[model samples]
Every structure is written in C-alpha cells, then in structure tokens.
Target: MVSIGYFLSCEEFGPRELVKQARLAEEAGFERLWISDHFHPWNDEQGNSPFVWSVIGALSEVTSLPITTAVTCPTMRIHPAVIAQAAATAAVQCDGRFTLGVGSGEALNEHILGDRWPPALVRLDMLREAVEVIRKLHTGRVVTHHGRHYTVEDARIYTLPEQPVPIYVSGFGPASTKLAGEIGDGYCTVMPDEELVRTFHQSGGADKPVQAGMKVCWAPTEQAGVDTAARLWPNELLPGQLAQLLPRPRDFAQASSLVGRDAVAKQIACGPNPQRHLAAAQQYLDAGIDELYVQQVGPEQEAFFTAWSKAVLPELR
Candidate 1:
C-alpha cells in the first residue's frame, strides 16, 4: 500500500496557517507531510512565502507526522553546508522524522542572489557536488571541501539527530533522474512517469522510496475549483523548461496567462468528485510511487480535508 501525505505549500500560506494545516492534516488522518521550500511564490497572486525552516519548527511541535521538503535547492541561494546544518537540526526537532528533499532548482528562487543560472547539465553537476558536501558535513566530522562549485573549510555541524538525515533528490528529466538514483537515499518528482522511476532504479535507486506530489482543488462546484486552480497555479501548465527559466513572479504570471482554465480543469482533479482525485492518485501509484503527496491547490483547504478524510483517503487506503 502506498503511504499518502499532505503537501504544505509554503508559497501559499504563512507559518501559523501552515502549522494549523499540519494539525488539520493529522486530524484528517494523513499519514505524513511534504512541505515546499521556496524563497518566493511562483506568482504574487498565490502570495505568502514563509521561511521553510521556521515553519518546520512550528510543525514539529504540532504534528507527529513525518515531514519532507518537497524539494529544496541546496546548490544555490544557500550553501550546502548551511542546508546540512538546517536539515540536521530539523531532524533533531522532528525526532528523526525529517527528510531533506533537494533538487537542481529553478531560476525563480535561485536567481535571487544574482548568480548566473547555469544550464541544466551544469545545475545537475552542482547538485551532485552539493549533496556530497552535505553528506560529508552530516558525518559530524570537520569537512573542508574545495570542490569545483563550492568550497567549505573546516565546517562541522555540532547538532545532529541520532541518525543522519535522509536526503531525497528531486528530478524532472532523464539526466536529473539518473543523478538522483546515483546519490539520493530516495527519489521525488511531481510527475507520475514510470520511465523516470525505472531510470532511478536502474541507475542505483533500486528498492528506494519513490515519492511524487500532485495538486487538486476541492470546492462546492467543479467550476469554482477550476477557476481557483487556474488563477493560482497556471504555472503548472507552462510547457517544458519555462518553469526553470523564468526568474520573476511577473514573468511567471505573464507566461501563465497563456494557460486557460480549461487546461487546468483537464489536468488537475477539481471540485467535489472523489473519483477524480482518486484517479489522479492512482496514476502515481501505477507509476510505482511508494509515497504520494497531495497539495490542495487553493484556499478551499478545510473543505478539501473534510471530504478527503471522509470520502477519499478511505478509498485510497
């Protein structure tokens, strides 16, 4: 059976609201949690980008659910050594129920520091090295790494959990997926691509946990749900590397303007239909995902949780 988790969108809600949602998620019987780590929301209309580490601390006090960052980019905007310390502290706070999910990252977040957004291959290489640095630091030994992309001199994280934090890598394409398998303790992605899962297993991720996240909108009516999803997350429909290349929220809004409500309705499971949500999750299951994280797309979180707890989670389970 696949474990179902709730995806707390840091891009959409404040820290307190996220903590509240974590409580609701646990009360609704969601087995685990995935929180997005972003410096900025994809678009301003979605609003609210709280520092993820602070929110994680709040969540630890409220819910016992295992939590994972649904992809943090440790290669840029923040150093891998710092991320190692944060993840280690988070693991301690969560009593070892935390996972560090990392990725190559997008320009929208990583470009904030005025660093040049490298090509996809270079980003993957940097991610590989970043993971290496983080692991070395996690060993509680003094790490002095002078690598091609990063240099860490005599950095040691004094506070760590009983066990080292598990690092899950996120990938969207073949190269990144292969890299994840080679380095990640687990693999995470947004799509239900069977081939990607196979690539991970073939490259060295065999029998490791595979996690994926999907979005849904639950509303009183299907049309209302569609409108909310389209308005808030049309970036989901932006084709190809557009999501990776776009540097600002306005760029995203401009790009997403081309995405229509019908497109969102067709892709995301919306409104009161439990069957639609189930089908969406089933797709990920069919792709051999061991863990599935679901994000409610808009503000109808209370209604969504109530319906899923009563109608959807039971069926999925």
Candidate 2:
C-alpha cells in the first residue's frame, strides 16, 4: 500500500507550529512527514521560514512519525558536508527515521549569502558532488576531497544512526530525474507523472521509492479555500524557471498577480468536499508514487486534518 504523509510547510508556519502540526498529523493517522527547508518564503504572504533542522529536533520529541526534508538545497547557502552532519544528527535524534531530501536549490534561498547562482547544469553537477561529500562523511570516517565545486578536508561525522540516513533527490526535469536515479537512494518530486517514475526506474532507481507532494485547502466553502490558496501560493501557478529565478518574495508576489483564484482552484484540491481531496491524492498514486505527501495550503490545517482523518484518508487507505 502507498503510504500517506503530511507535508509540513516551513514557509507557512513557525517552528513551534510546525512541531504542533507534526503531532496533530500523527494523531490524525499520517504515517510519515515531509518538511520543507527554505531560507525564505515564496512570497511575503506566506510570512515565515524557520530553520528546518531545529524544527526537526523539536519534532523528534513531539511525534513518532518518520520525517523527511521535502527538499533541501545542500549545494549553496549551506555546504554539503555541513548538511551531512545535520542529517546524521537528525537521524540519530529521530532514531533512524529520517530521510534527507535534497535538490539543486533556487536563487530565492541560495542567493542570500551573496553567492552567484549557477546555471541548471552546473547546479546539478554541484549537487552530485555535494551528495558525494555527504555520503562520504556519513561513513564515520575522516574524508578529504578536492572537487570541481566543493572541498572537504579531513572531516568526519561522530554521531550517526545505526542505519545510514537515506538520501532522496528531487527532480523537475529529465536531467534531474536521470541524476536522481543515478545518485539518489530515492526520488522526490511534486508532480504525479508516471513517465518520470518510469524514467527513474529505467535509469537506476528501480524498486526505489518515489514521493509526491501536493497542497490543498479544506475550508468551509470552495471560494474561501480558493482565495486562501491564491493569496498564499499563487507562485505555484507560475510556469518554468520563474520559481527558481525569482530572487525575492516581492518579485514572486508581482509575478503571481497574473495567477488567478480560478487557476489555483483548478489545479489544487480546494474546498470542504472530501472527494476533491481524495482525487488529488489518487492522481499521484496512479502515477506510481510510493509515498504521498499532502499539505493544507493556508492556516486551516486543523480543519484539513480533522476532515481527512474522518473521511479522506480512510478511503485512500
């Protein structure tokens, strides 16, 4: 059976609320968790981006569900070796119930340190090297490496889980998908594209897990949900590299002006109807997702979780 997980949106909630949400999710029958890691929210309206690792430490005490970083960029802003250390510590804290989900990263988060964001190919190369560094560090041995994009000098991770933390790579395109297969222990992506799942398996990720995440708003009415989604996540409707290239929340908000409530409603599962929510998750399952992660887009997480626990998730299971 495909596992159902709750996605903790760091962009939308503070650290305490995220921990609370994780506890609520476990009570509501979510089997796992996916937490986003970002230095900034997509737009000002989302209003928050807390340090995800700190939040994970809090979650370890509050909830027993396994956690995964929905996607973290270990290539810039934070060095891969540092990420390896953090992931190792997290795994130990979570008692080996952690997965490190990584991606090439967006300028919105990576550019904060005054580092020039490289092109997509270069970022992927950097990500590969970073993953190599992380894996090397996880071995609990001193590692020294001089690579094209990163340098590690006699570094080692002292604390680790008995089982190595699984590293999942995120992909949005063909090249990334191929790389995820080649280098990642598993694959993480938002879309329910069967071809992408097939590609991951055909290339090198056969029998590995593919995780898909989506956002929904369960409100008193459809229009209310649509409005909330549009106001908070209109950037989701932006096509192509706009999500990667837009450096600031204001820029994203400006671009998102073109995205209408109707467009968001059409794409996201919105409203009080449980069927609408079920269908959204069903699409991902049909596309061969091994794990499904769902997030309530706005602050109505209480209603979403209550309704899903009562109605939606039982049917899905």
lDDT of 2 by residue, 1-317 (tens): 99999999999999999998998999999999999999999999999999999999999999889999989999999999999999999999999999999999999999998989899999999999999999999999999999999999989899988988899999999999999999999999999899999999987999899998999999999999998999999999899999899899999999999998789999998999999999999999999999999999887888888999999999999
lDDT of 1 at 39: 91
lDDT tens string, model 1, 45-144? 8998999999999999999999999989999999999999999999999999999999999999999989999999999999999999999999999999
lDDT per model vs. reference: 0.95, 0.94
lDDT of 2: 0.94
Candidate 1 global Cα RMSD = 0.7
RMSD of each: 0.7, 0.6
Lowest-sum lDDT 10-residue window in model 2: 296-305
Residue 45 of model 1, lDDT score: 89
Q: What TM-score, computed on C-alpha atoms, does each candidate reach?
A: 0.99, 0.99
lDDT of 1 at 167: 95
